[model samples]
Structure formats: structure tokens, C-alpha cells
Target: MSKAVKCLILLAVIALFFVTELIPLAITAMGGAIACGLLGLIPAKQVFSGLSNSTVVLFAGMFVVGGAMFYTGLAQFIGNKVVSAVGTGENSLMFGLMTVGTVLSAFLSNTGTAACLLPVCLGICASAKIPASRQLMPLAFACGWGGIITMVGTPPNIIAAGALSNVGLPSFGF
Candidate 1:
């Protein structure tokens, strides 16, 4: 079989595995990359090169930092203050969650912001008797929208800046 066909088949299997919850998504991703390498669809070196990229390093650092905030109870403390300030009304709670998520995502990785705030949002939901489903979507949407406010807020912004620089245009600052 052609290498492309083999790669496609491997991807399909990976998707099936992901849908079936047969293995962790991380493992499935790594295994799919390995399979592509073994099938000669992508070089092994190229597949592994992503691990050393600065973007990957930044993502890992942000994830650790977010986790540290939670571990140190800083997240809880900040969340409690925000919740108390906003009161227990459903609209107030939703506004508080979106505002916090947006502000954090503007300065940090969106995923990292979401990770840091997920527990906080859940706690507020539990305490206020608000449905988690109602608040989580607004939080996520706010994060996405807020990431567009700064050049470093999302990967696509960085990629666009890099592309501009490659063409001798001024890169985005801050």
C-alpha cells in the first residue's frame, strides 16, 4: 500500500480509538505519530522535533504555572473573593466567571487559563446551585474571544507574526 494510504488508515484507527476511549488521547497521539514514522509517512526526527519547539516549552511552562496556582490555593482564594464580590445571583456569577476567564486568557495561554479556572467555576456552580453546563460555555467562549486581544494570547497570533517577519514585514509587538 502507498505510504499516504497507510497514514490515512492509521489516522482512522486513531480516531476510532479516541472515540471508543480505548486509550488516553495523549498516548493515541504519540502512537499515531510513531505509526506514521514506521510507515515512512513522516520522518521520526521530524515527528519528535515538535517536542523541542519553543511553543511546546511555553505551553508546558504555562500548564505548570496554572497547576501551581491551584496547588498553592491561590486560585481558590482569588475565586472566593471574586465570587463574594459578585454576589450569588446567576447573572452576576456568569459575568464574574466570564470576566475572570477573559482577563486571564488575555495574559496567559487560553488552555492554561481554562485549566486554572475550571475548578473555581465548578466550586461556584456548586455553591450557587447553578448548572455547570450553563456557565462553562460562556467561560470558554470568553477565553477564545479574549485571546484575540493580544499577540501572545494564542498560537495563531504568534504564527501570524512569524509569517509576517519572514516576509520582511514588521512583526507584532507585545
Candidate 2:
């Protein structure tokens, strides 16, 4: 096929993947980037730009900072403080976890927020006699939405921030 045809085919295929929700969005995007390079739709450097970009560095730094927060017991302390303030009942427990996930995801990694809350979530589930499977998905969804509340919550947001900045827009602070 021609280059334009390849581009169209690629776009259609990727769009279909997204519309079907068959894989994670980021994974689909990465696959598209790789295919672009392999099919000569873009230069190799462009395909690999995601790795070397400053936004990627920012994301890595955020993840490291998140690890530091956990290692220093900051997340646990925050969780405990919230639980203490709210007083633990089943409703309050879930609300507290969701609240923490939302607040932290505004400034930290979504995955990191999930990681930080995993043990605590399990404890809540066990204590409340709630199924881990039932509650985990809601927490995950909350974290994902929370991550969008700020630019640094996830890599895609960072990437979007960077792209907008490149076009002379204002920087999005975490």
C-alpha cells in the first residue's frame, strides 16, 4: 500500500482497537508508535521519542517520589489519619480509601497510589467482610479518574501537557 494508505490503515486499525477497548490505551498507543516506525510511517527517532522526552522523565521522577513517600510512611500516615478522622465503618472505610486515592492521584502516580493503598484496601475489605474483587475495581476506577485531576497523575496527561506546552500553551503544574 502507499504511505498514505498505510497511514489510513494504521489509524483505522488503532482506532478500532480503542473503540473496542480490547487493550489498555497506552499499550495501544505504544503499539501504534512501533508500527509507525516499522512501516516507515515515521522516523525511528520519532517512534522512540516517548522514552527520551522530558515528560517521561517527569513521570519517572514522580514514580520515584511516590516510592519515597511510601518508604517514608507518608502514605500510610495519611491513610491512618484519614481513617482516624472519619471513624471506621464500612462506608467510611471505602470513602476514606477512595478519598486518599483521589487526593494522592492529584499529585502522584495513579499506579503508585494504587500500590500505596493496596494493603490498606485489603485490610479494610477483610475487616468489613467485603469481597476484595468487588471493591478493588471501584478503587481502581477512582484512582484512574483521580489521576486525571492533575497533569502529573499519569504519563498520558504529562504527554498531553508537554504537547500543549510545545505549541506555546502554559505549563501544567502538578
Candidate 3:
């Protein structure tokens, strides 16, 4: 088969695996990368290079820390404190969550900030007798809005800066 057609077939299989989740997502993803290398779609050495990226490490670390916070009940504790401080009204809850999410996302990865705060928001929602669905969308929107505030706030921002520098333009600061 032509390489392009083979690559497309491989991609389709990966997408199917991702959607169906018959295998663990990480394993499926890694398997897909290895398959591409074995199929001669890409140089083998480049297949794992993405794992060494700083952004990947940052995200992995954040997820580990977030999981630790949830396991230790720190997220619950913080949620209780926020609920007490802000009161349980829907507007109040949204304001508190969005403010926190925006600030956190402005300084950290938006995805990481959202992941870390999800448990805290869930805790807050549960105690307030509110549906988690009500608050979750606002939290995501807050993170999206905040992610544009700084150069390092999201992967897209970093990529944009890199693109600019690659084209001989000045990169964004901070």
C-alpha cells in the first residue's frame, strides 16, 4: 500500500480505539506511535521524543499533584471553606469558582487548572445541594478565558510564540 494510504488507515484504527476505549487510552496512543514507526511512517527515534517535552512533564506533574490533593481530601477541605466564605447561592458559587479558575489558569496550564479544581468544585456543589452540571461549564469557560491572559497559560499560546520566533518575529514575553 502507498505510505499515505497506510498512514490514514493507521490513524483510523487509532481513532476507533480512542473512541471505543477497548484499551487504555495511554497504551493505545503509545501503540499507535509505535505502529507508525514500525510502518516507516516516521523515524523511530522521533516517536518517543514528544514524551520528553517540558509541557508533557508539566501536565503529568500537575495531574499527579491534583490526584494527590483529591486523595488527601484537601480539595474537599478547600471546597468547604469556599462554600462557607462565599455562601451557597448559585451566583455566589459561580463567582467564587470562576474567579479562582481564572486566576489559576492565567498562571498555570488551563487543562491542569481545570483538572485540579474539578474535585473542589464538585465538593462545593455537593455541599450546596446544586447540580455539578451547573457549575462545571462555567469553570471550563473561566479557564478558557483566563488562558489567553499570559504567554505560557496554554499550549496554544506557547505554540503561537514558537511559530512567531520561527518566522523571525519576536516571541511573546512571559
Candidate 4:
């Protein structure tokens, strides 16, 4: 088969597996990438190169930290405090989560804030008997919005400020 057609067929199979979920998502994803390498669609060496990127490393570190929080019971403690303060209702919990996420992301890297908070949110959702999906998506959005609030919260803000200063314009502070 032509490379393009073969690649498309592979993509279709992967998409089907993802939608049907017959196999675990991560396994299916990895399998698809490996298949691409075996099929000569991409260099075998490059198939896993994305995993070594800085962003991936940062995420891996954050996940480890989050896991540590859960293992240490910190997530449960924080979840308890949040549950008591916010109450168990879905709307209140969501509002509280988004507010906290926004405040944190305004002062910290959005990705870092989200990664650190993910386990806590999961714990909170579990204790509240709510699906993590309902709150997690909104929390992610809040973090992104918060990153726009401060120059140091995200790289784009710093880059934009630097560009302005290089052009002899006043740059934003804080």
C-alpha cells in the first residue's frame, strides 16, 4: 500500500480502538506509534523522542509529585478541608475548585498548578461522590485563564513583555 493510505488506515484503526476502548487507552496509543515505526511510516528512533521532551519531563515530574501527595495522604487532607469549606454540592465544589485553580495559576505556572492540584481534585471528587471529569475540565480552563493574568504565570506573557521592551515600549510588571 502507499505510505499515505497505510498511515490513514493505521490512524483509523487507532481511532476506532480509542472510541470503542477494547484495549486500554495508553496501550492502544503506544501500539499505534509502534505500528507506525514497524510500517516505516516514521523513523523508529523518532517514535519515542517526544517522550524525552522537556514538557513531557515536566508532566512526568508533576505526576510523580501528585502520586506522592496521594501516597502521603496530603491529597486526602486537602480534600477534606476543601469539602468542609465548600460543601459537597457539585456547583459549590466546582466553583471552589475553579477559584482555587485560577488563584494558583495566576501566581504559578499553569501546568505546575494543575499537576499539583490534580490528585487533590481527584480525592475531592471521590469523597464528594462526583465524577472527576465534571470538575477537572473546568479546572483546566480556569488554570489557563489564570496564566494570562500575570507576566510570570506563563512563558508567552514573558515573551510578549520582552518583545515590547525590545521595541522600546513599556513592558508589563509582575
Whole-model Cα lDDT of every candidate shown, in order: 0.83, 0.82, 0.85, 0.82
At residue 170, give the lDDT of candidate 1: 90
Clashing pairs in 4: none
Selected candidate, larger TM-score, 2 vs 4: 2
Question: Candidate 1 lDDT (Cα, whole model)?
Answer: 0.83
Give the top-scoring candidate (lDDT).
3
- In order, what is each prediction's RMSD in angstroms? 2.9, 5.4, 2.7, 7.1
TM-score, model 2 to reference: 0.64
Candidate 1 lDDT, tens digit per residue, 1-174? 887788788989999989997999999999888887878898878878778766677667767777787889988997898788998788898898899888878877786788678889999899988899889999998888878888757788867886788799998868
TM-score of each: 0.77, 0.64, 0.78, 0.56
Q: What is the lDDT of residue 6 in candidate 3?
A: 98
Candidate 2 residue 16 C-alpha distance from true site, Å: 24
Model 2 residue 68 lDDT score:
90
Residue runs of model 3 more than 4 Å from their true location after superposition: 130-134, 165-168
What tens digits encode model 3's per-residue C-alpha lDDT throughout 61-112? Answer: 6567657766898667767777888999999999889988897788777887
Q: Runs in model 2 with CA error above 4 Å?
A: 1-52, 127-130, 168-174
CA RMSD (A), model 4? 7.1
What is the overall TM-score of model 3 with all chains considered together?
Answer: 0.78
